[model samples]
Target: MTEFANPGVGTFAAWDYVVFASIFVISSGIGVFFAIKERKNASSRAFLVGGRQMVCGPVALSLTASFMSAVTVLGCPSEVYCHGASFILFCLAFSFVIIFTAEIFLPVFYRSGITSTYEYLELRFNRVVRVAATIIYILQTILYTGVVVYAPALALNQVTGFNLWGSVFATGIVCTFYCTLGGLKAVVWTDAFQMVVMLLGFLTVLIQGTIELGGRGNMWKIAWNGQRLNIFDFAVDPLRRHTFWTLTVGGTFTWLGIYGVNQSTIQRCISCKSERHAKIALYLNLLGLWVIIVCAVFSGLVMYAFYINCDPWTAGFISTSDQLMPYFVMEILGHLPGLPGLFVACAFSGTLSTVAASINALATVTYEDFVKQCFPNVSDKMSTWISKSLCIVFGIACTSMAVAASLMGGIIQAALSIHGMCGGPMLGLFSLGILFPSANWIGAIGGLAFGVTLSFWPAIGGFIYPASASKTLPLHLSTNGCLPLNISDLLSTQLLNFTSQERERSILAENWYSLSYLYYSPLGCLGSLITGLLISRISGPKHTTIVRPTLIRPVSDLFCFWTDKGRKDNKEKTPSDNDRIIRASAEKELNDVCIQESRKIPSIYIPEQCTHINVLCVKETYF
Candidate 1:
């Protein structure tokens, strides 16, 4: 490892340490102030959802930070390093999903008047589906948070010489403190600060790397000639790693789990002041992610250029590919005035921000899904306390998992694979709730079980089916690990690389960019949608009216017909239909009671779906 440099205690510059320390202290300071403010408004709903008054700027920035975690900063660079420019093109596939979400799901969620996004499951299908989706989210959050927690600490340990576990706990501890105290408000505010520091630190490294590598032109020339910049390989091979089809499809599915179903992203959108403001937040967030992703991918290209002949992983400078970016930063930029400290702090900030956001979302799910529904009489104060307590516990659990991640090499691949495995099923469950109106409780539950079981296969062992099983069916693995990378390369060379057309076909066949990450969203979404529909059809439609489908427009529109017609049919004076008379009598009694008690309660502020004119005004102010 190049005779590990001993940064002597006396030689350690005060200014450099101070620069990194300031970023952490300043970020925590913002979180602490907000935590104090949020504690004052300790209503259960307010603590979890920020009283639904969050403006666009904070929401946009926080969402950006939440979305761009250590995964984007570290894993993406590794993806580009291993696969090349095709990973960069993968980001574009998600832009359309973001657009669809802004127009389709955002409005429906706002109108539904629920705090947690999983509430849509209860309102649409049944409590079982709601519980199923909530559990999947909690499971995914823990795994995802563990990765975000582990990767950056590994990087920090490489750069700053801190204990691996110590760095993970230290980062998790600060995030837990403010997140537990301040709630969503604190997480969002702190994320805004973290996002700024993260970008500045990365941009510093990128510019420095460019300068050290001669310039942008030199970097690209080397990358292009070495086949690192190739994005298109028009071969129709299923075993290929990154094809245009896989990139678009897999990338879209992967992001849908993050932005569409994950509570971390949903929490930000729900906190916005109005529906239009939420869409604006989402739009601005997509734009920011585009910029951040390009920068991250470019960072990888620069790393490739810097170490083309002497690849760090192959040369044994670093133990794994994920360490490539960290080593590159420390090797070239470590000697700069304060740049090393800035990048190290940024790396930790990415981990901390994501863990904090995930912890907060987990707490919200616990309170809303399990506590409130299970124990309907808990007081607001106690409920808020439970939420805070859960955050503390989950934070500790995630820290333990992060420490464990060190022993398991290929941190990026492990983290991403875990996400795909856990997140794919969750996305499927949500799709069933939003897309299929007739998805009864039985069907929903069955689909959940099936999806969860099916997604775990690739993680345990590579693929189970025959090599040429499905036509044009790209080989996929849920977890990204070194074992699979070695397997894929070996198999491709010895078996699949034989054709005169195949070896000279395209570099994409050799690179890891074969199946783009975008397809994960559609695969998961449609997979669950079909599963739920088939199950519901087999169950033969339950007699009772299912919960209202209020999250997505099409499902809600379809179910509204049955619910409305049933109400109208019963309202008619038809004594011949004895069932109708009983339903009408029950409705009359409920309406009378509702009228008698209407004047006693105060109304809460809830944002409503707006008209085009109001939406325009909201976009102007929010954006």
Candidate 2:
């Protein structure tokens, strides 16, 4: 066994284990309670979406906890420590994404009343398109959840001397059990409890660190003087990472894909009793996101303040900046007995909430989109059982992937790359369906395939041939207080040589790989959208039938104002009259196709007004 030089500073005591164990016990108990309560009604819908009766508050908190994850809790502080505060601008972009998601994406999914978000693809395009989108989402969630599971394990390993694999398996098995037993109800309630623990732990560190550092004023002064208070970097270079444009513009598309189109966020929203309540939950989620961001950022500032003089990196206490947060926690809270355990519990909670959410969402899309469609005769009880089994299977898969992820470098970048790789293509498919009525299944598939290929090329290349592009920040840190003169001289010389080495590559390779990871999602979305649109125009419109109004956003209709004057004049008609003309055209085409091809087209009733329509307004909804 590896021994710590100072047990109090680097190892967990008996009380610490007690506090951490209590969290697992309580979380598992909640699952048992819900499993017993809902045992009689074990339908697929109830298992997946909680019977559409989840309240606004807990669901909102659950969404927040899921999105925050261990990635945000641990990664954000490290980001601030290493890169500066430019990342805080993501909050603004996230707010815009929330508004867009609420007004555009949520209404469509909630109004359609679909079990899986990808079902909209089948309705708007084809079954092939739906399956393609579902596969992409599953791949993305698995890759991401693995990284989420690995983050806490890696951090705990550094401070608590616990085996990394032990942490990973413990977290994975516990999360899988509760999610499999109680389903979404257990996941949401446990997430709410975990969210509280997360906040309390963060606030505890912030308040305690501030006092130790002589109050907030001194902490801010020290951080600002050391050049760690980087807020707005207005640089306009796309290749330069973490600038204003990257965080705001690039971040908007990234977050839109995450919150707007991802099934995890959509599942929580649709679980609510009404669209109104879901909207309320979404807004509450925005508030929670901001709070979490602030806490993470401030924690970074606090870490900087505490280490302003005695730099941990130079002193050789830690190997990477990612380990800095846990190191700081153990250093400051070790003497307080259960405090270290509480902090570990907090990190574990983040990992658990996120992994549980992902596993549950993955099972949902798997069973609803694939298994049920493939095995149409499966009963509801059997289907629910399949979903539960799937939850366990995916949880195990994620745990295995977590072992692989441990060998990877930079948790934040790895997680975001995986998310962008899949999220972009999935978002593109939805955007094509909702924004462009002319897009066909051929175009959707082609676009997604091409987009995914482009996104993954850079990711795989970077992983295989990892190269560092930027220089480390020149923050104020001195070894005068912690290191002897001779050792300090050697350390400074080694750092100087490392920084001064030449990074040489061909111009083509440099440009290709130099594209900031932040732009990956936006590029993928744009590439897929443009490709789909072009292919659709080339292939001509396949669906001449009346497009469902709920599938089309009203904002997209505003493009009608910018059409050529001649076309607009010829098409001048009231909105209701325009709807009638479109319907008549669709009817004519349907009759002609039916006669020519000798095939029957399903008929459905629709309202004259778009605004008054709901899921009930149309029957035979799927083509």
Candidate 3:
């Protein structure tokens, strides 16, 4: 039998190069085509939101691709392999995420008709809140984009001998080019194509691996007997990594922050032709996310079963768990000329989709919130050019950040920690706006500042002073029957030593730094919400008495208790209050008329219809 060694540089064949190169060429071609197609009407709105004429199918696929970054592609399988299938339980949270996002957050942003999600903060609170939220989002996206790009590049470097930086630049530049020139339309379409490629590649590896492991039944039996099929770890311990509580309850808040208020997702939702279509896209995205995650989980089980008698980690074939997926691909499909290349293409596809979405979203929020506010009179043509330029600039910044991420210990942990830090605070601010009507701007600003500080403290501390040992649970493995005698000896020497006192810290240190990262989003969100409520109560009520129904939760309409209380309050109003109520009723009437008209009209009929209706209603009310 032949001995196995770690794959070195130049491990990938020429056909593999062809497959990888094709992705770049096709992605760039799509960008150029869209750039030329929309050249005549290159307005900021068109570029940033695809003219708000996007369909549900492509938008849904784009959302799925954007959310399923390289971290999911490379890290999910590794997670399953290392800690069993408890990670799969997180899939349970997707439905809740979709429902909450659609029912609560989508209507608010869709009704507001804002280009940037951060704009909601400005409308509900003050400019200070808007600017703060934008900055936080920008930081989060930049950091997260780097980690997304880095994950696949690191895997490629390990399996194919490709330079990590080379892979990073290649994916980053291609994504930026398409996103810059093609705008949101190009980004969404390419993302749809990439998602298809990713699934094809993943399934190819999974099917081939399962067959080679003596079919699915044997594979499952081996994995189950090895304790790799533990799907439900119902432990309530927050300190334990993958429990039912962490995966379900904690995952709900994590995904809520991701799908609910993140600019990338909000942009996709608003880009749809109507709120109905956006909801369809969100549900479709949920389905797609589930498919990709299931594929990853099964691929992990296949890898574990294949390597049962030949542990790669014990044999020193790969340095990190993230490398396991790519390593398994090369080992199983290396002989099938183009398959390895397909796997590399899949990884790059995920990275490109994520980075492209982020660059477009970043360019969008930057242009709309900061640049356009200063230069509101800039022509649409000039605005489009400026937005494209911002895409390129942020693309370079993200690539540099990707370089920094390469030095980090774990891709999934680093990416999620960044998300929790920024996304949590941003979600908190929006939650206060949507769920709590009395939360003022002063409260929002103060709560956001405090929440950000609280999240950053733990994240930075954990990274700087990590535990001496990792906290991952072990999976059963044996190498006694391996062909190579040396591999068997290596496995024997590395006897299972799960006893490590790595996390035995003081109570204070444990509470602060050892807080499970899963709870970061919830904690930060609750921190912001509680703080905002307290501060708002202390500062007393705001001078303005009006409450926009669209800006708050729609639960008032469903609960008769709330509706009855609202009616009672309305009856107690003074003459001035009655006049204001009459104006508000007129505005609502105008909105209803506009909605009815919009349904009958073509797509071209609604350009800032909400804004126009507000203007007409105000002019007719008091004049």
Candidate 4:
């Protein structure tokens, strides 16, 4: 009955199924091939870090996979549908974060020569700091991957009329199978393929929807008329959503958590051959992010244009607007053979890539930080096998969690809140390890616990005990329904709960829900830093020692010392006269600088004596 549907077929044609099957089979095969190779070159370091030779494409792909999980793919559109232009600003903080990682975090990590980035915490701080950080990351990734995988399964259930379990089961079997088989190598390569598929599937929907909506201009016009095109609301209020300052600062920290501290991202960089290549890989990741974000934003507009007059949620056709994109794809692109298959495959790929990457990274951390640290004599083969086994265990746990968790919240908000809860503290711990030399294990651990508790409080209501009457502010609405002074209280219980009919109607009034996602990271980092310092000061003990200035030198110095430490005898340095003479000569040579000044006058016009005089002046002043 639909204009887009074909006459001969009742639902999807055979070719569409074939196309979908072929893509899945091919992508799976590619993963299997890599798995075989990984098994062949099996070693603890190789399994954990691909022997440190990952190229930009694989690194970029894995980073993209881990970064742009299904939560992102599905949630960005949902945010666009609900908040209009604000989500664009919400997502822009990533650009600056990527820049920070490229210049600051990547160089330090690549130079450290460690398999897990958290090991740097051990080297810089202590075992307790490393363990605490690794534990939080593992916990966050499990929850994060669970939600990510769950969202797409829910989307599949809505569009195809399959049971949610069937969708979950199908996705889990495939993702778990490949990830357990391929290790990090398979995860990275498959992620590259998934990124391509994810972009294509969304763009297909975007193009089809755009065409159906009449044109790109018409789409923007509809959004503009609806007041969804407003990006800047120049109100200097802290409670206001999408402010420039919030986006720049809060957004920066949130991203710093992901790129600078999170293993899911940093592992890819650590896998590269050298820090230079790692930096290159990070920039390429940013460039790809720029393209991917543009595509995602366009897809959002396309959805707006397609559903402008007759919102699907209003008609009771789809349970939620998150279902809007999937419904659009099936209704519009189902007729095109292989396209639906490609689309689903793309969706599955994104979910699987993230799940696999998270599990592998967690497994690596568990083995190194917990297992090996506890049992120092474990053989390389046993450690590697233990990590592989843990990967299987983690995959099973994530799958179980995915099925158990009922629908939570919008993909973007849920992802952000989850990240915010754990990421802020993790970022703080790493920052302390890398930047603050005085941070001891007790301080690091205390700061981490405090940061986690503080960040977790807002997410799961007040921490320890509920806030007292004095601490809690009751909501009073203006005539316009806008609670001007504090919206955090209003948002507390109802964070990201916008699909309800009453809630949607409330959003139409002037009292729109607006909160900054950026503040989560810095708040967490600050929480960790302050708490750690306080704890360290209080728990001053004989065992706690300051890091030597030599040890706290730049990354280059660390590498130089690490590479040559064995050659330098630890015995007392009996400096000979020749040794002192050589040191003096080296110091003088280091300080030497040649200053040059050239006379512009023609040979006939300039005197040789004047040229020599100017040269002496230049040398005396500049050098």
Candidate 5:
């Protein structure tokens, strides 16, 4: 507790640097190991997809690390600090997200055996739809990587007094070095390693902090008294941020965009050794995400208890709420050897995993969609180099985008905003192709355009005219616990301005910019679906005769309720028994070892996650 040189700041120690440096060395070492091991292998597939024989456990860890990012580590706590514990609802929504993605999306992508999920667009519709979705994915990944890279850098810089750009480059360089060296395998393995680092680093702080603030009962009592324990709001108003409805409904759509369709996770899913392994990977990922979210939310409660009376920003101790976690870590964990460094490493581990995942995915889409099309005759030797080069190029681009992210307000909101605005449209595009037989390329492109416009209007408006939110704290923040930093006058003014801030938020709350960000993904997904349907019908949909049955997921097989009746009907429409056998044998040509060709009868495995979400058995027939 007395570790800080001053009341609010702590410095990094020699052991801290030693612990932090190990993360980079080990991460980069993985890349070097894979590069040497596979030197004789002469194809880009090895680089891009681990030869499609990647271990399922690492893929699951990579998926969790890729999606959680530093944003969840840093932002979730800050969110709880300012907005209460409503984020718990958002984490809970992943239960449904994983079920839908694992059962519906994973099967189709694994069966198609495409490197990029966008490639499915061309198979289902046309190249135009594929290109459009690819471009949107690229934009979303770029923006998100920027925010992820910047978040931890900002946190470390605020506490350590290190140059922010220095922290940014350190993260980008190490990530790029590993990713470019070993490709997807390196990225996956490093992500697995970092996942352990993240859990150990973050949880250490939570445990130590909870100890500093007394026992769990006393800690909960403090949070309850301060209103940080508020987790439910049944309000249906879309503009009211973080209500139960908004968190649950809006979070479901957001997770769908991330898990169901995003390239980062999809690449990992499709690269696994078998379909069963991929499904298992996804289930494990959901549990990892849930752990991170719970830790972060409780960490936020811990932060609020410590600063409830002091009001860090009002007292001029920190510039933003995001800094609170880092500052607290420095103060409480700095005295102990390696603890602060562990926390810093934890934050940056999230950045490295996320940035590397994005770099790999960006390279994947570029190689599969653009390079292959533009140069049809490129040699495997040269193409492998091209993919590696693309990783370096994107790694730098993401690093540079961190500058732009600096001005994008809170990292979590900005990252998710990009996800919803761009990812939602792409998710819709994929959903349209996978769900509806009548969908055409023209309609998909039109729908994507509409969805983007609908989602971005509020995002852009909010960027220009940021909305103010009224205070909802049951206990008012006090400066009584704060020591004089010699700015008594400024603190007094901030206290007075609090009411005016709330007033302004109320006025802006009526405008489009004030629309709760949670609604963005749903708006885009639904907009795309409706518009695509309208345009498709108007232009004339192709007959089901032209659509491949494999591309469209059987809806009845997805849910028990739908399957009990739907499977019987689908059987009537399915090809005769002999035709199905012939087609199944032909599809096994992909790889006997890489893909599973099983078509077992329905088996009911009611997972412990939820009651309604059933894990359907892989159908023996391709209905």
Candidate 6:
């Protein structure tokens, strides 16, 4: 049996609501500003990619804000507090990973001049592979949307008794309204603003918590003495969670999946004014994300120091570990006017930024990949409107999904694992297309299918039958400080009600499924790579020169023989010296068609989409 201190250990004051509501007003106002200011820019390109003229600073901040969603603000602290500062390793891993991205993947993307990263897939493999990757990205984004929205709402519900579904809907609707109205620029600008507020809230808590704890030195001393600094563990065990190797090695694949091929990241990286600006944005983004990670983890350490003698779970202050941070806020900052509101607003800002970015990316992908593919000649106004409409639809759909998923109780907690299961395969598929020139469409498709299958089998099993981490992380907390409060009710026995009749389901998962979630990326990536290579050999390696060498990453051809321009493959069907022109294109002025059409057949091909040809002869005349 357990006794809770109260339903909500921290209640909001009168000014808290006002402070929280202001973030919504300003965010929505920015959307209105951009909607009216850029009303003339109605093309889908302008709307979705900001005409590729966006400044790097806000775009960089937006990139940081999007990934540092409510999950990072809330979950990372919980992670650090429970498992120690091992979460810091993820930030460091992402740093090196970003450098890899900038050096290897970023150059290829910028050179391609693509609206969607999926477009690269088509240029490299074919339409089928591109469409498959797009669908997977969309699915990954939607499942993740529920998590961002639901986390802040859950936090509010636990701390202030705010309505969970109400907050979820409000958060989703606000994100949709702005994302659909202002498009990419609005989302970026709004994210930049919200990021500042989030920093303010974090700083306030950190500074105030430190003041209460005496000083920074004391803050670290308490954390060190409490054994919450276990960050240097270099254990080589796969089953153990949060080891140095697991984080850096697995984290490499995870961040690679996120920054290399993710549509939202791709759009922001390329939306900058130039290659220099784009690279600068990514570097700045690295700094911003690293700051948030440090703040969140340090805040967790601060929270631990405050309740070191009286663990909140044992003291009955919070029902679950997730509530630790929010409850700590109430205990320390509850009395201060508008401070609680500021913190809540910070969480809300995080949720809105993440959700809005995903919604905008969803609309972008839909317009580029689906709508344009179906109706290529559609007018710009109609296409842009359709993109906006998609923003709304995706927004509402995500909100509803979040609400519906709430009914699943604790099962919704596994959503991250579910989303992560896709990361490995998606990363693998893209890496194959970029680094390995020998991979074909058959291999790409089959490899993706096989990679996802490999990831989910163990991921899902571990969720259902969670391995006890007790031996790995023995309870290092006590409630001795609360003994005088008379509120302690320990669960001395964890349900002896079995009466020896249930047989305890004597099965355990010590096999492959028991592998740590951190290794999911490596498993999927390795599986996809090996399987794709084997399958491609059967499909005859996509015929060397069919794809331009620029589509492949730099230096990739050094070891890859197929990507060399001089490769003569039997699969290529080249025409002889007397080969006739299979296709010709001529453009004359704005009409994009050659004049004198009646004279000598003009040699103009009126097609934006065409099949492979033996040779192309183009003629152009402007008058």
lDDT of 1 by residue, 44-117 (tens): 77888888899999888898888688777777787777677777765676697688677656666666777788
Q: Model 1: what TM-score? A: 0.79
**Model 1 ranges off by over 4 Å:** 1-13, 407-409, 463-523, 543-549, 555-623
lDDT of each residue in 1-623, candidate 2, tens digit only: 12113223557889989999998999999999999999998798899999999989999999999988888878888777766666678789889999989977887788676879988888777788888888878878888888899877887797679898888999999999999999999999999999998998898889889989989999889778767776777888766667788889888888899999999899999899888899999999999999998999999889888877666755666766777788888889888889988988888888999999999999999998989889988887998899999999999988888877776677877788787777877788788777665567788888988888877777676666444434334344664555433245655666666555424555544566666777888878888988987777676644434455556553334333223542333222222212422366655764554344323322222323222222122211322
The global Cα lDDT (0 to 1) of model 4 is 0.65
Question: Model 3: per-residue lDDT, tens digit, 46-117?
Answer: 999998899999999999999898898899888888778877877889889999999789877886778899
Best by TM-score: 2
Q: Local distance difference test, per candidate?
A: 0.67, 0.78, 0.79, 0.65, 0.78, 0.75
The candidate scoring highest on lDDT is 3
Query: Better model by lDDT, 5 or 6?
Result: 5
User: Mind giving the per-residue lDDT tens digits that candidate 4 earns over 1-623?
Assistant: 11111111124567766765665676577668877776667677777787877888778866876687777677677656656655566456777888777866665566555668787777666776787788788888888887877888887677755478776766666766676666677778878878888788777777778888888889989778766677666665544445666666776777788888788788878787777777787878877776666666677767766666545543445666677667767777776766766666666767777777888888888877788778988877777778778887887888887854455555666677678879989888776655444456788888999898877755554221222222122122111221223234434434344334234333313121223444556777899988886776576533344332222222322332323432243212323223322245433332231112332211011112233543444233212
Where is model 5 more than 4 Å wrong at Cα?
Answer: 1-6, 471-475, 485-509, 542-545, 554-623
Q: How many backbone clashes does candidate 1 have?
A: 24
TM-score for every candidate vs. truth?
0.79, 0.88, 0.87, 0.77, 0.87, 0.86
Query: Which pairs of residues collide in candidate 2?
Result: none
What's model 4's lDDT at 11? Answer: 40
Alpha carbon lDDT at 278, candidate 6: 81
Residue 448 displacement in candidate 3 (angstroms): 1.2
Between prediction 1 and prediction 5, the one with superior TM-score is 5
- Model 4 has a clash total of 4
**Which residue pairs collide in model 6, if any?**
none
